[model samples]
Target chain A: MTMTDTNRQWRLKRFVQPDEILGEEHYELSESPMPTIDDEQILVKTLLLGTSPAQRMYVTEERTFHIAVEIGEVMSGRGVGVVMESKHPDFEAGEIIQATLGWQDYVALTPDDKSDTGKNVRTVQKVPNPVRPLTTIMGLFGQLAFSAYVGIIEVGQVKEGDVVLVSSAAGGVGSVACQLARIQGASKVVGIAGGQEKCDWLVEQGLCDSAIDYKKPGQDLAAAIGEHCPDGADVYLDNVGGAMLDAALQNIAVGARVVICGMISTEYMNPRPDGPKHYFNLLYKRSRMEGFFVFDYVPRWPEFEEQLREWYSQGKLKLVDDVFDGLPSAPRALGSLFTGGHTGGCVIRVADDPENIPAI
Target chain B: MTMTDTNRQWRLKRFVQPDEILGEEHYELSESPMPTIDDEQILVKTLLLGTSPAQRMYVTEERTFHIAVEIGEVMSGRGVGVVMESKHPDFEAGEIIQATLGWQDYVALTPDDKSDTGKNVRTVQKVPNPVRPLTTIMGLFGQLAFSAYVGIIEVGQVKEGDVVLVSSAAGGVGSVACQLARIQGASKVVGIAGGQEKCDWLVEQGLCDSAIDYKKPGQDLAAAIGEHCPDGADVYLDNVGGAMLDAALQNIAVGARVVICGMISTEYMNPRPDGPKHYFNLLYKRSRMEGFFVFDYVPRWPEFEEQLREWYSQGKLKLVDDVFDGLPSAPRALGSLFTGGHTGGCVIRVADDPENIPAI
Candidate 1:
C-alpha cells in the first residue's frame, strides 16, 4: 500500500472556557508535509483516533492533567496506526501500532525516547497481531477498556452480590465498567445517564439492570439511585463528577467503593463546582472513595487485557463503538463525549484497516 | 462515704438549629431519685463524662449518627464511673467501669442488653485497671483515642517517612491522631487548629511538627498547608471537615489517604456545607479518601488499646485532657468543642475518683 504525502491535522485554536461546551470552534484544521523518520525512528500513518473525556483537559488554559496541548499544536490524543516506514530494527513496515498519535495523518516516533510520558502508554508500540474493524482496538482492548478494568475491578472492587452503580453509563469507560461489574458477580447493575435515550440504551444493551434518566425534569438523583439500590450500591463508578457523585454517595452500602475514573462534568469548570454535599456518607457507612489514572497501572495492562479478552471471547463482555468517519470529524467526535451524544466508546476513523491485517 | 439520695441530670431541652452554636441553653438540669439495680443490672455513680464533637449530632433534629437524643431525654454520653451496687456476679462495689452513663449523676446499666448499641462501646465494661487522675481513662484509653488510632493507623495508613496532617489538632480525636501519626513514624506532622494559642499548644506539646493557625486573619488555608507540606500530606486525618478538609485535599501527595474522622464544623448544621472541591485531586494523585466510625472497629478495639498502652508506657505517647470540674460544667464543656475553648481532649469531671480505688 502507498502512503499520502500531505498530512491534515487539527490544532488547538483556543482553550475552553469554564462555562463553555467543547466544540469544533476550539480547534482549527491545517495541512503539513508528511513527517519523515530518522534512524531508529518509525513513520506511522494514523488509522483511528480514540476520544476520551479527559482529552478536554489537554486544551484547557491551565494544566489540569499530566499532559497539556499548547495553542497551535496538534491536539494531543491517542490512536491506532500502521508503520508505513521503519528505520528501527524492532519494527517493520505494515505493522499496526498504538500510541499518542495526536490528531494528524502522519507522524514519526522514536520508540526508545526516555521522557516520562514516553514511559507510559504514550510510548509507541506495535499492536499485537492485528484485528479487523480496528475500532475494537480503540474501544475494547485499549486505554478505555483498561480504565474500566481498573476502576470497576481493581479500585471499585465489585464483588459477588454487589449492587453496582455507574455514571455516564452509555459512555466509553462507564459502559465497560457496568459490564465488568456484572461479570465480577454484582447482583444488580444500575446506571445513570443524561437522557432517556442513553438510559434505555444502557439497559437494552445489557450493560445495566436498570438505568436512571438524570435528564428527566425535576429528577432527584439521590432518590432515584435509592429506589434502584434499596440495599445501597456496593460499588459506584463515577465518570461524571458533581451532583451525580453526591447522589451515589448517599446510597452507598457499608464498605462501598466509590471509584473516580473521571470528572467530565467539572473538567472545564475553572474554580470547579463545590464538591459532593453528602461525602460524609463515606464515614457514616464506613465506605471508601478512591480515584485512579489508568496510566498509573500500565505495568499491569497486559493482565487486565488478557482477562478482558477472555471475557469477550466467552460472550461475557461486549464491544460498542460510536465511530465518526474520517479525520475531519475528530473535533466533533471528541465534543460528543461531553454532550452525551455518543452511544458507546467514541472513536474517529481516519483510515480503513489495511488488507494485510487479520481479523480478531 | 454515703451516696446522695437525689440524682442531678441534664436533659435535651431542644434540638439545635443549623447555624446556632451548642450551649447550656439546649439542655435543662433536673433532679431525680437515685437509680436502683435489678437482676443482672448495676447501679453506677458517674465519675466523668468524656466529650466529643459528635455529641453535637446527638442533639440535631435529624439523626446524623448511629444514636440520637430526643427532647426531654437524658442526653446520651459515655463516661467512667464507680460501680456503686451490682445485682450480677461479675461486678462488685467500688470497681471502676466505663459505659454510656449519659449526663447524669447516677445510671442503671444492663451490661448484656442484647441491643445494637450494647454490641458497641456503649456496652458497660469494667476498667481493666483504675488510674489516678481518672481523666486518663476518659482521654488516653477511651473512644477518642481509639478513633485516632483507627483514623491515623488503620485508615490513613500513616507510615514512616510520611507527612501527616490533622485537622482540629487540639481537639479530642485530633490531638490523639497527631501523636499516633508521630508514633507511626511520620516524617512530619502538620496540624490545623483555630487559634494561635491552640496551634502553639499543638507544637509545644509535641503533637505536631508544625501547626497552621486557621483563625489568623485572611489566612489562606490551602496555601498555609502547602507551605508546611510542600511535598503534600501523605495522610490527612480530617476532624473538622468543610473548608479544612477541602484545603487538605488541595495539598495531598500521590496515593495520599484522607481519613474522615468527624465533621464537627457542619455536624450541627441541618444542611451540611458543600464537600471538598479539590476532591478531584484524589484522581489526579491516584489517592484514596475513606471514613470510619470507631464503633465499626469494636471487634478490634482491644487490639488497638494494647498497642496504645504500650506506647503510653514507653512515653512515646502523651495524655493531655482539658478537664471541666462538676456535673454543671457538662453543657458548657461539650459546647467548648465547637467554640474551640478547650486545649486538649475535653472531658467533664462529674465526681472525683473514690478513695478505695487504686491508681495505676
Candidate 2:
C-alpha cells in the first residue's frame, strides 16, 4: 500500500562558493508520499542513512562535485535499503540492497537505473570484515584501514619487528592503522596524538605500544619519534602530512617507507603549506615515499573483506566507530574531526536495525 | 720534478644569511708548497673547476646543519683530473679520474677514499669504460644520467608506447630523461620548459616530440596538459613540483606512475614552496607517486649503466652539456639555473678537454 505525506525527502539547497554564505536552514524534508512500483521499478525502504564529512563537502562546499549538483536536488548519500515491493524480477521483497538512496524513507528504481543496488553492499571492497562493531568498512576499518594497509603493506611494505609511526593516532584513521600494523606483525607502533588523554588510552587499550602528545608547545617531534622508536621507523603511515611528514623523513631508518594517506593541513588551506626542502634525506637514507587511495582496490574487495572479517571475528582487529545519530547531526560530527575529538571511525546510525543492530 | 707552488683553497669566511655575501674574497690559496703525497695518495692535475648548487648553499646560506659544511673548510666537489703521480695501486700514468678533489687545481687523496674515481662514475658506483670521452663522464653521461635513468626506468617504470611527461625537460636531468624515455621504448615524450628558445631546441634536437613553455603567462596548464596528452599520461618525471605537480595529478591515466626526481623550483627558495593540498587524487586514481634519489640505486648501477651504454653506443640517447668557460663563470652558471637560462646540463669548462668535449 502506498501512502502520501508519510515521509519527507531532504534535499541540497544550493552550491556554496568559498566566500558565499553557509546555509542556516534545515534540510527541506517534505513529507512526500510513496509512488506505485512500475513493471521495471522496485520500491526501496532505506534502513540506514550515511552521513559523512565527504557528504557535507559534496553538498555545501561544491568543490567535491566534479559536476555541479542541482539547487533543489535530493541530497546525495548511500544507504542500505530493504525492498518493500518489487516489479523487477531480480529484486524480491525483504531482500536488502545498498544504493545512493538519498536521505528519505523510500525510493522507486527502474531495473536499468544507475543507482540500483542489487548486490551485497555489506563491506567496502579490499576492506576486510568481521571488523564491523569495533571497526568495519563503514569506518577506518573499511576506508582508513585500506589506506594504512596499502601504505604499510603495499607501499611501506612492513615486515616483522618493524617500527611503525602513525600521526594523528587518536583520530579515526590513525587509530585503526595503529592496530592494523600490530596485526600485520609490526614490532612496535608509535602513535602521535594531540593530547594526553588519547595518548594514555591508546597505550592502555593495546592499540599502540607507545604514544606522544604533540600539543605541548616546544615539544620536539623528531626526538619523540626517536625516543619512541629506538629501532627507527621502517614504515610511516602519515595522516597529517605537514611538519609530521618532515619529522618522519628525518628519523627514517634505512630503506624506510613513508605512506601518504591524507594531509588534512593542506586541505582547507587557501594556499597549501610549503613542504620541507631537504628531500635529499630520501637519497641519504635510501628510503621511499608513496601516496595511496583505498578506492582503487575496489576490484579486490571480496578478498580484503573476508580477511578483515576473520580478523574481526577472532578479535585481532577492533572496530572502533564514533557513531552519531542522524542526518542533521552530520555537520557537528564532522567538525569534531578537525579538533581531534573522535576516535576510531565516525559513522551515523540511521535506524535500529532490529535484526542487525543486536539487542543489547 | 716537484713544481713548488703555493696551494690555494676557498673558504666560507663567516656565517651569513642566504642573500648575504656569498663570497668572502679572502680565499687564502695556501702560501705553502704542494702537500706531500702519502703511500696511498695520488696527485692529479686539475684542468677545470666544477661548482654544484648545494655547495653554494652550504658555504654561504644554510644555517641549519643537516650536513654541515663549516667555514674555513676545504670546499668539496667532483673534479675531473689527469693523474700525474700515483703512489697507490689503482692509478695508471696518464689515466683520468673523477674524485672528491675539492675546488682546486690539485687535491691529495688515498686509493680508499670514497671519491677516488679512476674510472667513469656513471652514478654513485664507478664503472670502468675506456672507449668513451672523459668529458662524457664529466658532462651529461655520468651522475646526471643516473638521475634520469633512476627517474624513468626504476621510478617511472616507463613502458613501451607510454606517454611520458618531463618537467624542466631541457634541463640537465630532464634532458637525460627525455632521451632515455625514447630509448626505453616510450612512444611520446613531451618536454616542459621555461622559454620559446629552449622549447624549440628541445623539439629540434629530437629529445621531445614537442616542448611546452611554462613561462608564458595565462597558459592554462590543465588545458595544456589535456591538449598535449590526448590520452592520459602513463609516466610523469617531475622536476617542477609545485603547480605542475598539481596539474599532473588531474591528468593521470589509471595506474600511472609519477617519479619525483627533483623539485627544482622549491630548491632555490629560502623556504620551500606550497605543496599540493588535494593529494587525495592519489587515492582516487589508485595512481602511485614516488620520490627517488639517483644515489639510492647504487647496487643496480651496473644493470642501468649497461643499458645506458648500449643506448649511447647506438646513438639513441644523446648527452648534451651547456659549458660555461671559466672559474669566475661558476656563479653566473649557477644563477642562470633559477632563471631557466641553460637549455641543457650546465657544466663549467676551466680547461679545454679538447680530447673529450669536441666529440659531442
Per-residue lDDT for B170-256 in model 2, tens only?
887888899989977999999899988889999999999987888779898867887888887889888777778778877777678
CAPRI quality band, candidate 1? high
Model 1 residue runs over 4 Å out of place are A116-119, A356-360, B116-119, B356-360
User: Every model's DockQ, to 2 decimals?
Assistant: 0.86, 0.32
- DockQ of candidate 2 relative to the true structure: 0.32
* lDDT (10s digit) by residue, model 2, range A136-188: 44553344555556666777777888999988887767777887788889989
Q: What are the per-residue Cα lDDT tens digits for candidate 1 across A269-351?
A: 77789999999899788889999988888889778878887898899988887889889999899989989999889999888
Compose the digit string of candidate 1's lDDT tens values, residues B1-360: 469999999999999888999899999999999988899999999988999877887888877567889899999999999999999889988888989999999999988884855337568868877556677787888899999999999998899999999998998888899999988899999999888988888999999999999999998989999999999999999888888889999999999999988888877665678888999999999999999888888788778878888898899888887988889999999999989998889988888778744222
